[model samples]
Target: MYETKTIKEKIKLFFIIFFPILITQVSLNLMTFFDTVMSGQAGAIDLAGVAIGSSLWVPVFTGINGILLAITPIISQLLGARSYDSLAKKVQQAIYLSMILAIIIIILGGLFINPILNMMNLESEVRFISKYYLISLGLGIIPLFIFNTLRCFMDALGQTRVSMIIILIALPINIILNYLFIFGKFGFPELGGIGAGIATSLTYWLTSILAILIIHKMKPFKEYQVFSAWVKPKTKHWKEQLKIGIPIGFAIFFETSIFAAITLLMSEYNTNTIAAHQAAMSFSSLLYMIPLSVGMALTITVGYEVGAKRLNDAKAYGYIGISGGIFIALLNGMILFLFNDYVASLYNSDPDVIALTVQFISFAIVYQLADAFGAPIQGALRGYKDVNMTLIIALVSYWGIGLPTGWLLANFTSLEPFGYWVGIIVGLSTGAGALLVRLRYVQKKYDKQQNPSVD
Candidate 1:
């Protein structure tokens, strides 16, 4: 009985899903941007500390929670298939899995992060502040994952506005808290870079708690009956979730971890070097949220089509999403390339930092092109329930090709951080090329399977 939508209608629907997710992503990255700016105001050392701390934990955060992210695609497909009866149970299983992951993160990452910092050979002051920053941020790991689980659930159902609004509300609070705690305002102890950690942690708890309350009370969520029953952790659910999620997690880890490793390597240079890297990386990351949101939308759209047994429609959505991503990426890259210096100045007033930032942003601009192609295709693949291949491809691209090239160039040549940036470009291009080819193969294969009489 459902009427088919025209291409224009589909595109509009994509943006409706995309913009809220984009807002949420922009808000999330802005939190980090604000943190870096606040710490930079404190001093070069503070900025470096926060940067290094971020470099260490961002990967861990992404990798661990990345698994839970699979819930979005899984649920989206189920919804498309009209398999409403099991939605609540599946959501419960994801929450239970998230809790287990959180505990492990706290025990391993929180308790034993110091040894890893020690091995990095950071300056004593930088090491001291980074340690506390990571630990303070670690305190909110549970709430963070809980928030992610719920957000993914809502987003898959095309209800992204709530999370966007919640994060928007939290952003200013985090900035205010950063100012108060970092500068010893309102009789609070001045914690500098560590203050950013506390501020972000508090924001995480607040947002997660709000999400839970809203989900429980919202009229829309009432149909899902997420809270109607308590289902104990089941082995089959655990295995299935893990089977889908672990590859997704590692894929994220491979991409993020290489960048983290580069940051660690840059520590040998100086605080100024690390500060500049943070500025450029943060800005680039902000731009990346565009394609990322587009890709996420693709995952939902494609998965829904696949589940609804609309294979041809899924192929069309995949191509439409990829084309949109590339166009936006090129636009973003041009802007960054054109205004790199002006943008860098906004992060810090330090001349050396700004100069370095300009250079790094140039590469970031180029990097966006590859990111555009790769990110959306990966999202499309997720919709197809094809993730293990992504993991394999990521490993080959990032570790096999990217890291070794960066290490050799940075250590033995004059490129330094630039060398690492070059590696990123190479790795992203490799992955993008391979993914696009793979997606074409998948689409054709699926089409063939769906229509045996097709030429």
Candidate 2:
């Protein structure tokens, strides 16, 4: 179905898919933004607690989500190949995998909570609130994964609007709940920062439930037969997903952990610093969704081409995705560069927080451009089912290089928070360069196969 389109048509199609995912991603980030904003209202300590607690679970959940993302390409490829019969089984297996991983993450989150907090040696109030927040948020992990599984299944089948709408609806719901729970309005108890976690958990549950109902009732998904039969967990399918997914998970873990670690490292500086970092990180994360959404759509687009044995078309999609992502990043970066302080003020009113936030945002502008190159290519590689090497590259660029540089500059040198920001810029640039080179190699290899030398 996708093989005959011109590059322009394909790029258009990519954006059609990309925008809905962007909306969904934006809403998800806004959920956190609202949480942080509400927490900030409570106090700086409350804001810090939410930020710290979120750092703990963002890596865990992002990693797990990355693993489950294997399902999208898997299904997209099958759809392209017209292998309709296998779709149901693949989706069911994805659900099984998501469920298992969700349980493990929740358990591990609970087990290590105390020790990790103690080791950090945070102030008593921040530590206490952070613990409660993590525990509350942990309860929602299962639902979060379930929603992701369903979303991936729908996305692979070229149905993204439903998930976007559902999430958007949940956004207002989340805001209201946050206000009620955090401030103890509407007859709800005032739980402060922990309220943000409670609100988020409930929001996930609501959205996941809504997603399931939509999938069941929606006419478009009827042909895939996702829920037709109860299939036992197939070891072969499990390994297939893990083999493809584990590396992607680790890659995400490596990347997210560095950011999380940086947030933790900043905790020693002062409450205002950590809060400012969180504010800056939050905005950058939202901007990141633009390319990330495009990249995700690229995965589906390229996966479909490869499955249909259209290598040239896959190459075209990759080029368009990379170029489009960079263009978008450049535009967003300019906005951040021009309005760093103004943007920072949106999160908090404190002058100190705003000043540091503007500083952090300067580094963010460069990294966003760098991420534009790496993130889409990473998605393209996933579509090509070449994830293992990407994982290695992520590890080397982020932890092996980025973290050490950031640590030395921040802890040992005069740069402090600025050092960590510099390290992030370096890490993203390294990853972008490497991923671009790798994508070029893959594309060239495919080109050679499609057209041999005349000599």
Candidate 3:
């Protein structure tokens, strides 16, 4: 149903899909940004508490969300193949899987939250805030998972604007909720950082409800009968989704957890250090949405072409997405380089925090460059279902190489906190190189398969 024969057309198609996803991603991250800024206003302790809780929560959320993301490529491929009958069933199974994972996470958090925080030797107030923040946040995990599953389905169908609109509607509500709860306005208790978690959870429920309504009431989506004809969960369908999803989950887990781990490790330093680290990390994450959006767009586009058996078109989309990510990264780098000090001041006004945040952001400029290179290629590989190798690469690069290098430097060298940034840069560069090679190999293999006589 969808075809792009020329590079120009492909680029146009890519951006059409890309821009909405970009808005969705940016809007989503802005929720987190507001949470940090609002909580920081409550006090530095509140900011650090939210940071620690997020460090524990984000990796887990992203990893599981990554698993659900498998639905995008799967559904996109099915769409490209024009096998419309099975889409509803696939989405139903993904929802079931998401529910199961959400319960598991909630249970695990209940069991581990106290022990993990206690083990950290954190300040009393910080630990108290972290514990409750996670607990409050856990309430929304199910709805959040469900929302993400639906989002992946919509994205695969090239209805990305739907997601963008939903998030935009929710973003303001989340900020308002954060304000009322954090500052104890309108008779709301002054919950500080914990309020952010509650706001986020409430927002997740709203988004999930909206997604369900849209799918049921909308024309093209309702045609899929995602709700009208409910399908029973089948172990076979779950396995099929998990097989592709597990590797993706671990790959993303490994990557995101490295940042989480760095946050936890920084907890050993003074509160100022922790807050500064989080501010820089948070802004860097905002910048990262650009490349991440491109990568996700590639997953849909490349997956569609691959499903249609248009391997050359898939390859072209991959190249375009990767190049576009790099170019955008260059622009981001310039802006960050020029405005690092100003950006740092936006997060907090403590002169020490601002100075340290500037240093951390300098390192982020390099970090973004590597991410721009690697993330899109990884997305392309997902299109090909080349995920197991990516899992291996992520594990080796982030945990095996990046963490160790950072740990050694942080403890044994003068780089201290900055050492972790160096390690991240190195690790990302390595992963990017490995992923690029993997993409080329897959491209050639598909090429050879299509034309057996090729040398």
Candidate 4:
């Protein structure tokens, strides 16, 4: 029987886990903003290319990211039970198994970059620029895979701060690279869009190498098979990971693809509108990191408790995380809404772009709120390893509601750009509601077993 933690303790645990992840997320997401701004400074055509290129390949990366990220929760759960053998196999298997998948994505994304851009019907300049960015982006896929694996390892072992430090250390270097390459300073070529990709790629590789070094040298964590030379992939065990990971991949893909699909759909509105929309989306995603990190911590704590057969603790932690998320989201949404104009200025300078961005901020605000409500609920589910059904919920909410509403509002209705945002709000709310209901039912049922009445 596990004792439940007080709300204050849960909040403290959440933040200790959150600040590090928040730092990591702020660095990671800033890359997106910086990537666009550097390219935008080069030309609108450069920015357009990035948009198109991102639309084409982001879903692919989402699938890969989700699968690889599965390692974290698995390791978290296993650690709860002190199962070092299972943890070692899972870590080793994930590292070796993911390399093959990453290579496939690299090759496929590399090969089809041009064709995909053309298919999107972007301008010739945009297509060319997109191809350049895609090549560098594709080249960086393996490095990202390696980096994420290490981050997951560290995060699972309860030191999410290590990943944050690596990201922060690499950030200054990334910024310098972009400045030099994008503008052709210091006798370097004006690589433009390619420069943004190259800078990001270099950062990925650098951070990954540093994570490798940390894992090898760190106390407590270095004893695992992941660090041992003899820890090779046992092919038979790949299925075990795939079972947990594949659904996660599709779960992530389902949500991310909806965004990508909407972006492509939104392009038909107007370039300025699309540009403003993208800017707001980027800012919103960055703001989203706070609640997202909260959700991640919830997933970790819930998994740990559940693994230890402390179901009451797991359920209590889930509510605490979710409540904290709501509070954080409301505060964040208000600030972002209040500072919409100033926030938009951080990314681009054009007045026309800034004007469109204001409306986009409203949508972004709603997403932050809805994400707070939904994300932790989903996080708890992930902690429970109930992935397949969540994918179904996402599919229905996103495709069934989100896609159609966006299309109607953006194209057919008088809402124009606001309609597009409204569509997102509706989608997020629907998904958030469904997820909450499911979480309640699941938690309640599980708690009965974990906390049965004495006869």
Candidate 5:
């Protein structure tokens, strides 16, 4: 599906895959957005409970599921190489791995939920709500992991629209369920924030079931016979995927945890300052989906070319994807700069919060610019299965440099909360530079291997 010969065709193909992935990303984010909004309607306490629960859940979920993300590049390369014989088994093994990971999360989550909550000086009701919310969310972990694994499979096969359609179908169901459970509609109990958690869990199961049904009936995927013959778990396959996946999982963990860390650090500030920071973060995260989708699309295209032994084609895809991402970032920056006030107003009516939010968003323009550069390059590197270096880069950039710098500035200097954002921007820029250098080196290494006579 990714055999584009010209730049125009490559761009066309990239975007076709990209737009659907973008929609999927946005839809997923909207689910979380709606979760918070609906819970807020229940009461401020309910909203706070859900927010606290999510702050812990989001990083863990993304990090663990990131291991399953390896499935995309692996499957894409198999398709490009036309290595069909082993595809189903590889997928099957990934399913097993996901199941194992999901169970571990459920167990660990149950054990640690109370102790973690205890450490935080939360009100009794909020603590109760937070504990139950996480427990309710835990019910869906298995299916969620399975759904993510299937999503990787679909994305790898160039059927991003299928996943997009599935999420679109599920999004409304989630909202409706949230309404029913949160407000006790249709004789349901008024469980408030806990209801949102239940709604999300149900939504996850629905999505996973839909994915299974689609693969069962779908044409190209049906031909693969992924579910027909379940293979026993093989340690070798687990190792192979883990070798590529562990670094990816930790890299994503480090990146996401940095944001969580920033949120925690912001707790010391006044309510207006904290709220403003969150508002800006919410909007900025929405904008991030654009470049993140582009990066994901690049992973598919680049992996396909590399698997096909078309090193030059892969290099071209990396260039086109990164450059296109940056151009889009420029547009995003302009939007943020031009409409900062208007955007801030959407989040709050208080003039203090609005003013602070606008300022925080100004910092986000630089953050987005740097992310536009870094995120896609990381995706491209994954295409080459060059993940270990990305993990190392993430560690040094985010924790070693980013968080420390933010801490120093926020604590010791006048930048205050804004200092954390500056730290994020610097870390992202540094990572982007490192990723660019690494991408160049990997491309050259592949090119040299392909044509040994070259200097």
Candidate 6:
């Protein structure tokens, strides 16, 4: 039944599948935004506390998220080839691999949360708040990892709607939980920032439960050998997943670590500045969902085409995805540019916060085109299972150029936060240029190997 799609139907299916995933991604971010807004309303200290704690946790989760990126591509390729038996074992393997990684991340997150808080030299209130927030949040990291596996499994099987639906269902529950805990509404103890963390932890597990139910009920992945093989985990299958996923883990970790590191630096400043930075970044981040989700779709499409031995179709999808991202970036940048102050003000009512938000977000908007342009390039590379250069690119763009440049701009120069953002643009642009060139070169080389001659 899945094999009956026409070319046009396939493209439409791609977009339809992708659009909901985009919304799911955006909704996930909204969960964070609401959590932040709730904390901010409690107090400036609460806002900054959660922000700092989040900075420490974000890199870890992002790296894990990256590590899991190999899933949809591998599964989709196998699914496309109708290799159901291999697909079943691989699914089990992904879960096993995720479980192992999740444990390490959870321990690391729990162990370091307090130390990182202390290192920030935050106000006594801010430090305590951060510690409380991180403790509860850390417990949910493992569930978050498990949820990641479910999400990819659903998407690869063309059940993207399952993840989307689960996330959507979880959001309202999260909001109600946050409201009850943070404000002590409905007979619950008022927990404030800590309440936000608890609410987040609950929602993480809740969403995973929802995904698990959906995956089980669906025909596509209902027979997954791994899901049924809950008795004894297959060590060989686990290694197979790690073989594909470990590089992804490193790539994601390296990339997210850069942003997290930057946020850590931002936390060292005044609380007001950190709050403002989060507000600015929060808005810029929401807009990124479009290209990022599109990139995800590109991965699935390319993987399927290659597995099906339709390389020309893979190349076509690559072009489509990259062009699509450029258009999205241009449109998103224009809107952000036009409504800088308006968007900034939406997050916080403070005039000072709003004003600073506009400045930073404006600078960020400048390089968004270049930033978005890189999504498909990296997506295509991941599609081809060619991430060996990911570490090099990440190091050069994020650490080698991005972090140092941002520091000089923020500290030594007059640009301050504005310069810090300019550095992000430069890094993204540089990475995009190099990755795109690499994609082109690889595609040509692969085509030549298959064709033997251009003529």
**Cα TM-score per model:** 0.97, 0.97, 0.99, 0.95, 0.95, 0.94
408: Cα error in model 1, Å: 2.4
Error of 6 at 248 (Å): 2.1
Estimate the TM-score for candidate 2: 0.97
Q: Report lDDT (CA) for all predictions.
A: 0.87, 0.88, 0.92, 0.79, 0.88, 0.77
Candidate 2 at 135: error in angstroms?
A: 0.8
- Scanning candidate 4 in windows of ten residues, the lowest lDDT window is 1-10
- Residue 312, candidate 1: C-alpha displacement in angstroms: 1.6
Model 5 pairs whose backbones collide: none
Q: Write the per-residue lDDT of candidate 1 for residues 223-283, one digit (tens) a residue.
A: 7889778888897987887888899899989998999999988878777888899889988
Better structure of 2 and 5 per TM-score: 2
Number of clashing residue pairs in every model?
0, 0, 0, 0, 0, 1
lDDT of 4 by residue, 189-264 (tens): 9988778887888888888899889888876668774667656668777777677778878877877787788777
Q: What is the C-alpha RMSD of each candidate to the true structure, in Å?
A: 1.5, 1.5, 0.9, 2.2, 1.9, 2.0
lDDT of 1 at 398: 92
Model 4 residue 239 CA deviation in Å = 1.6
- The alpha-carbon lDDT assigned to residue 298 of candidate 5 equals 86
Candidate with the larger lDDT of 2 and 3: 3
Q: Please write out the lDDT profile of model 3 over residues 335-443, one tens digit for every residue.
A: 9999999998887878999999999999999999999999999899999988999999999988999989999999999999999989899889889999998899999
Candidate 2 local Cα displacement, residue 369, angstroms? 1.2
lDDT score for candidate 5 against the true structure:
0.88
- Give the local distance difference test score of model 2: 0.88
The list of candidate 6 runs beyond 4 A from truth reads: 1-10, 223-226, 229-231
For model 2, the superposed segments whose C-alpha errors exceed 4 Å read 448-455
Residue 48 C-alpha lDDT in model 5: 60
